[model samples]
Target: MRSSNYDKFPFVPVAAQADACQVGWAAIAGVLQAALAAQPAASGQPVVLAVECYPGTGLRQLRQALTQALQPARCLVAGDLYRPTADIDAMVAGPLTDDPVFGRLNGLTISDFFDAEKLRAAQAELAAAAGELVLVLGTGATLVCPDATVVVYADLARWEIQLRQRRGEIANLGSDNMAEKASLKYKRAFFVDWRAADRLKKQVLPRADYLLDTNDPTAPKLISGADLRAGLAAAVRRPFRVVPFFDPGVWGGQWMREKFDLPDGPANYAWGFDCVPEENSLLLGFGEARVEIPSINLVFAHPRELLGEAVHGRFGTEFPIRFDFLDTVGGGNLSLQVHPLTEYAFDKFGLAYTQDESYYMLDAEPGASVYLGLKEDVDFPAMVADLQLAQADSTAPFPAAKYVNEFPARKHDHFLIPAGTIHCSGANAMVLEISATPYIFTFKLWDWDRLGLDGRPRPIHLAHGAANIQPGRTTAWVEQQLVNQIQPVASGEGWREERTGLHEREFIETRRHWFTGLVPHHTNGGVQVLNLVQGAEAIVESPSGDFEPYVVHYAETFIVPAGVGAYTIRPHGPALGTECATMKAYVRT
Candidate 1:
C-alpha cells in the first residue's frame, strides 16, 4: 500500500489514503483519483488526467485497490479509465470495461474493481456539480493533468541486472563455461594366428620389446602348447574375448575389450600395454571374442596424451570405422569366405570400407597350398551350394573347389588378403592369420563344421561368399611376380624370407625378422603391434625403455604404443629354438 504524495488544497479532499499496492497499480489508482478530487464540483469541465505507474506483478491487487478508491462516500470523483477519454465517462465506476485488466491496466489476476462511472453518473443524475472527467491508469503509462502535473512510472532497470549475471560464466573472472571437446585419439592393436605371431615376433616385434615380460610364469599362454590349459572359465565353456589394455596390478577396468559383451579369459592370451591411472580406455568386441591363437595387436588405440579430456556422452568416442580381426585358421582346402565391397559397406555403414587385410603363414606343412583366387571354368552357384553343405557338415564330402590361384606357403610366408579376393589359406595344415580394421561384413560360405570350442556347428555365408567371389582366373597366379611383390618382410635366421605388401588403411608393411637378439627400438609414427610365433621366458624392459634380455616362447601377441619406445630382447639359447624366434609389425598409415 505504498503511496505517491498528494498535493491538493481544494474540497479539503479527505486525503485519499490508499491500501498497499504493487509497485505499479498504486500509482495509477492514486493519481487518477487525486486529479478528480481537485475538480470544481460545480464546473462541467472535467479535469483530464493521463496516469501511469511502474508495473511489477500486481494484477490481483489492482481490482481491490481501485474498488475502494471509488466508494460512493469516498469518491468526489472516481478513477476508472485507462485513457480517461471516451465511453468511460458513461459507464459505472465499478468497472469501465468487462475485458479483464480494465482496458489492460490490471492483469488476469483480478479480484475486484469499483465503478468510477457509476459515481460520475450518480453525480450527473442527481444534478450534483461535477465536470465530465477523464481517468487513466496503466503500467509504464504516463499522465498529464490540466493542472500541468505530469506523473510517470516505468521499470527498465531491474531486468537488465538479472540478464547480465547469467551471461558471465564462460571464461569470466568468476567461473568457467566448460566447453565440450569433440575430437579424440587412443592407442589400439589387433592380431591372430600362430604363424602370423611367429613372423611378427622375430622381425618387427622386437621393436615393441617393451611389452614382453616372460619371467612371470603366471602369464597366460597365447597358443596353448601340446598341453592346453584353461583360465578364469572352464576350457571354452564361457565366452572368451580380447584382453583390454592390461594393468599388471589393478583388477577391474583394465582392458578395452571388456566394455562390450566380450568375455575375459587368461590375461596371457594377447597381452596389451597400458599405464596406471589411465586417462581413458575403451575395449570393443563384435561377437563372442574370436580367438587369434599366436596373436597380433590390432592397434585401435590412441596415444594417452590425446585422450586427456573427459568423455561425456555415450558412444561419444566412437571410431570413425569398424575395427575387426578376421582369422582364417586351418586352410579348408578351398578358398571360401568373402566380405562385401566398399560400395556395399558404405551403403550399409555410411562410410568407405577400410578393412585392407593381410595374412602371415604361421605353419605350412609340406605340400601346403593357399587358394588366393578362383581358377578358370569355376562355377559360382555350384561352389556356393557345395560350400554350404560342407560348412553345415564337415563330412558333406564336397568336391575340391577349383583354385584360381595357389601359392606354395612355407613358414613365415605372407600375402595380401585384400577385400574382393576370394582367397583361403589352403589345408594340409597352415594357419593364415589376418589383420584388418574393418568389421567383418562376412557371408560365411563355408565353415567345415570347424567345431568351435563349444562343439556347436559353425555358420556359413553361402550367399555373401558367392556374391563377392571372382572366378575364372589362372590356377597359380599368387606365384606370379606381381602378386609375389606384395608379401611379408623378414630379417632373422630359420625364417627363409620376408613377405610384404602396400596395403590400404587396414594394413601397412609386415616385418618377418627371424629372431636374433631383438633389441627394442623406437618405431616412427604409431603403435608397434607384435605377435610371438614361438619362444618363452623373454626379458621385457621396464618403463625407462631399458631392460635385460629374457626368454620367451612362440604364440603370443603384444601391443605397444609410441610412448614406450624402450626395451631389449634376449632370446633363450639355441636349445630353446633361438633360430625359430620371429615376428611381424603392423602400423597405421
Candidate 2:
C-alpha cells in the first residue's frame, strides 16, 4: 500500500483566544468556580449550578469531582426524579419492540421519564436552600433547574457511548439494565433514549453557558458555549472531516490495521466509520485545547447551511448520505445480507429512507469477488429454506454459491445495491461503501458458520430478508444494471469526469474525477461528500477564497457543506505530479 497518510484525529481550527478552553479537572474546576463567584448574590438565595449531561456520560465520576471541588450544600441527582424503573420499562416497551436489532422510533421526551410530583419537589427543595452553594446534576438536570445561575452541558460522543456500553460501563437512560446484551441496549438507546436526549439537547445546547467534553473520564475539556457554537459555524463554511473510528469484528480484516497504523491489540479491524455524523466525533481546536463533541451537533445546529434547503426540507436535520469503509482483505466474507425496502423501513422502523448503497472497490486481491443477487433460474422458496436451515444449525453451512452469483472484483469497480437486493463483499476486498444514512436496517440472512466476537451466534433475520428480497433480481439483471456502469460526462485540460452508477433507484449521485490539474467543483445547492480514491494527497480550496485550503489523503473522506458554493481540488504534496482521482457523492436534487 502507498505510505499511509490517514489522519485519525481531524479537527477544525476555530478562531478563539488562547485561554478560551480549559483542560483537566483542576483548570475546569477553577473556571467553574470563577464563573460561580462572579454571579451576584440573589436576595440571600443560594447560588444554583446545573450540570446537565448527555446520557452515557460518566455522571458518578463527574459528580464526585465537582462535589469535592465546589463543596455544594445540596447536590441533587436528576435520576432520582425519574419514575420507578418498572414504570419506565413499561412506558418504553412499545418503542423498544420485540426485535433484537430493530425498534420503532417514538416521540418520548426526557420529561416523560420523570414523575411530575418528584420534579416539583426537587425544584422546591433547590429554591429553599438559602446562603449555600447548590448543584443539580444528571441527565435531566436542566429540567430541574432551568433558571440556574450557570449551566454546564456535559456531552459525550455516540461512538464513545457505544464503546462504554460494550464495556458494561454505563446503562441506558432511566434504566437499570447495565448487564444486558450490548446489542439490545443499543436498540433501546437508538429507539428510545437517544431520540429523547437529542430533542432535549437541541433545546439545551443553545442556551447552555458552558460546554463540557466528557468523552475522556480522566481528562475533561471545557469551553464556553459561544466558542463551541463558533467552531460549529466555522466547520459548515469549509470542508472538514469528522474523527474516524475503527472496530474489529468476527469477519474483520487487517487492511486498516496495517495501512492506517492502528495499534496492535484487536485481532483485526473490519469497519471504519469515516463520515457517520450520528456516531462519529468532531474535534474543534481552540488554540492548544482540542474538544471533541458529537458530529451530529453540527447537523442539528446548522441544517440549512450544511445540508441545502431542498435536502433539509426532505431529511429535516438529518444527514442523508454516509461514506464508510468495509475491509475484508486477509479475513473472511461479510455476512450475507439484504436491507429493508423503503416502505418496509418506514412501516416497521419509522425510518424515512432505506440504505440504498454501492460498494466501490478501493483495493482487491487477484481473485477477489462479490456475492450479489441470485443465480439464474434459482428457486426462491428453496433458497429461503436453505438459509433457514443454515441459521438453525450452525454446523451446516449454506450453499451460497448455488443461490448467489459471484462477480469478479477489481480496483475502482463500482457495484450498486439498492434496497431489497441481496449483496455482500467477498473476502480479500477493501470497499468504500457509499449509501443513504439508514445504516442499521440490514437483515443478515446467513453468516459463514462462525460465532461472533462474543462467542455467540450472530442474529439472523431470514424472515425479514425473505420478505424484502427481490426474487426477480437474477444474475442477468444484476450484471446489466449494477456492475461498473461508468460513463464519461465531461473533460477539461488534464482532467476528466465520469458518472458512476448508484443506480436509478437510489437517491445519491456519484461522480469520479481523474485529474492532473486543478478541477473546479460546485455543491449545486446540496452537500457534497468526497474521497480521494487514487492518490496519496490532494488539496481542496475555495475558488473565491471563501474558506481555507483543506488537504485530504488517500481513502480519506471529507465533506463540503452546501454553503461552500464553489471549490477546487488538485494533486498536492506526494501526489503533485500524479494523476489523482476522487469520487464525490451528493443528494440528487
Candidate 3:
C-alpha cells in the first residue's frame, strides 16, 4: 500500500447524466427517499447532500443532473464558505518543513485551505431550509457535513489531471513561472489534492453513498451504494492499463516524443510514467464508458491476487516493482544522485521499500556515457567539501569529472544500481528504468550547477547523500559489481533466453530473449511485467484460453497477472527478423 505521506479530469459529449437522470436516478432516488423518510420532515430538518470532489471534475454538469434527478431539491454551490484565496496563498508562502524530500506537509493540505467552522454554519443554515439541500464543494465539505443524508465523492486519476492541466482545463497553482514549467510545477497543488484524496479514502469514502469516476466528460461511471474495497478488488481481476503520463524536465529528451508520437510539450518530453502506479492512473473500461482510478488502490485491494502469495506476504500490499523511462536523447545529463539504504528510507521517510534500480539502455548515441560510482583515487572529505562549495558558490572546488567515474553506455546495456551507489544517466541516452516500487527516494547530490526548468535551483541533499555514500564503490567496484553478469540460461531450436538481471541483492529479476517463432512464458504463480523492447509489435495470448490475447506495441508495458500463470508471446510485423528482443521481470524465487 502507498505510504500516508505519498498522498501521492474531462470533455462534453452526450451527458451520461441525461440517461442517468431518467433511468439510473431510480436507484439513487430510492436510497435518498429512505434516508429522508427516516429523518421525518415534520421535525423541520432538510436533507443535506454533500458533494466533495477533486479539481477539474466538472461539477457544473453533475450539479445540473442532480437538480433534475432530485425534484424540489436545490443544488447550491458552497464556495462562499471556503477560505479566501489570499489565505491559501499566504499558507503556501510560509516556511517549509525540515525534510525537503516530503516538503512542508501541513499548510499544503485542503484542511489548511478551508474553514470548517464556516462550512458547518452553512450546513446548518442549509439544513434549516424547506426543501432538500445539496452542497457542492471542492474541499472540507465532507468533514464539515457529517450529518448529511447522502455523500458523494467525485474523483479522477492523477494522469487525467495532468492531461487536463496540459489542455488548460486546470489552472496553474504554483509560481508565475509555471506557465513555462512542466506539469511538475504544480507539485504543491498535486500534494494538497493527494492528501485530500487520501483523507477521503480513509475517512469518508467508505461511508459515501455514491462515488463518481469523472474521467470521461461524456460518460462517467457512478457507483451507487459504494464499497471502495470491493470495487477495487473487481478492478484488479481485469487486465487494465494505467494511462501513460509524460513530463518535461531540464534534462528532458526526444526519444519518447519520436517513438510514441507524443505531442509537443515544453521543448521535449523527458520522463514517462509508463507503469509507475504510485503516480499513474488506471483506466477501467466498461463498454463505451471509461473510469479512471488511482493505480495504487489495486495494491491495497488485492495484495495476494496481484503480487502472488510469497511476494504479498513479504511486502504486504506494496507493488514491489516499478517501470519508468528516462530520456536524455538530445538533452542534458540527469543529476548525480543516490538513494538511501532500505533501513534509512524506512526509518527516515516512512517508506516500505528502497529504490534499487537498473538502467536498460534502449538506445544510446555514440560516445554516450553513464556516471557510476566514484573515481579510483579521490579524497572522500575533499569530494564532499567540493560538493558543498559548489552548492554554496556557483563553482566547484574541483571538477566533478575528477571525482565521478563515467562508463561508455551502449544499446541494451544493463547497469545495476543498488542503494548507496551514486549514478546518473548522461546525455544522448534513452533508458528504461526497471526498479523497486519506491521511486521517490532519490537523493540528489549534484546537478552541474544548473537550475530546474522552473527557474528554481534543484534541491541537493549533500548531507543525506554523504551519510549514505559507499566511498569504496570506486571504478573497480563498479566494474565488478555494477556491470551485468549475463549468462545464457536456455535455448531451443528457434529461441534462446539470457538472464540479464538476477543479482543476489535485487528482488526483481530480468531475462531477455531473441526469438523468431513463438516463446511460451509462465508466471510461476508470480506476476510478470514485460515489454516488447525491440520488436515492432507482438501478440500475447493464453494457451489454455484463460484470458483474451492482447496486442502490445513496441515500447509498451503490460502485465500478466499471477492467476494467468502461463502465456505466450509471438512477434507480428511486416519487418521480419531472425529474432526480436523482449525483456521480462518478475519476483525472484
**Most lDDT-accurate candidate:** 2
Q: lDDT by residue for model 3 over 35-96, one digit each (tens)? A: 55665443566667677776556666766656666654555554456577666556655332
lDDT of 2 by residue, 1-589 (tens): 4446899999999955658888888898999999999995488677888999999989888999999988998999999999999999999999887888888888999999999999999888887887678999998899998888899999999988998999999888999999998988888888888999999999999888899999988889999999989999999999999999999989889888888889889999999999999989999998777899999999999999999999999999899999999999999899999999999999988888999999999999888899999989999999999998888876778999999999999999999999999989999999999999986899999989988999998889988999999999999999999999999999999899999978999999999999999999999999999999999999999988899899999999999999999899999999998999999999998
lDDT of residue 162 for candidate 3: 66
Candidate 1 local lDDT, 1-589, one digit each (tens): 2221111100111112222111233444454466457643445544333223222212233334445554322222223322232232233222213321112111111101133454345345333323544333333122113231222221111122112222331111111212311000000000111111123223322222112111112221111111111211121121112232322111112212331222356331121221111111222111222111111222112213111122102112222211122222222343346665666556543434435555566555678666676666677677667776776565685565453456677765666666666665565433435444443354455543454333544345565456666454345543452144544443443334354553442344555444546444344433444555545433344435232222333444444333444544445544244554445454444
Task: Report the number of the highest-TM-score candidate.
Answer: 2
Residue range with the least summed lDDT across 10 consecutive positions in model 3: 3-12
TM-score of each: 0.41, 0.98, 0.79
The better candidate by TM-score, 2 or 3, is 2
Clash-forming residue pairs, model 2: none
Better-scoring candidate (TM-score), 1 or 2? 2
Clashes (N, CA, C under 3 Å) per candidate: 89, 0, 1
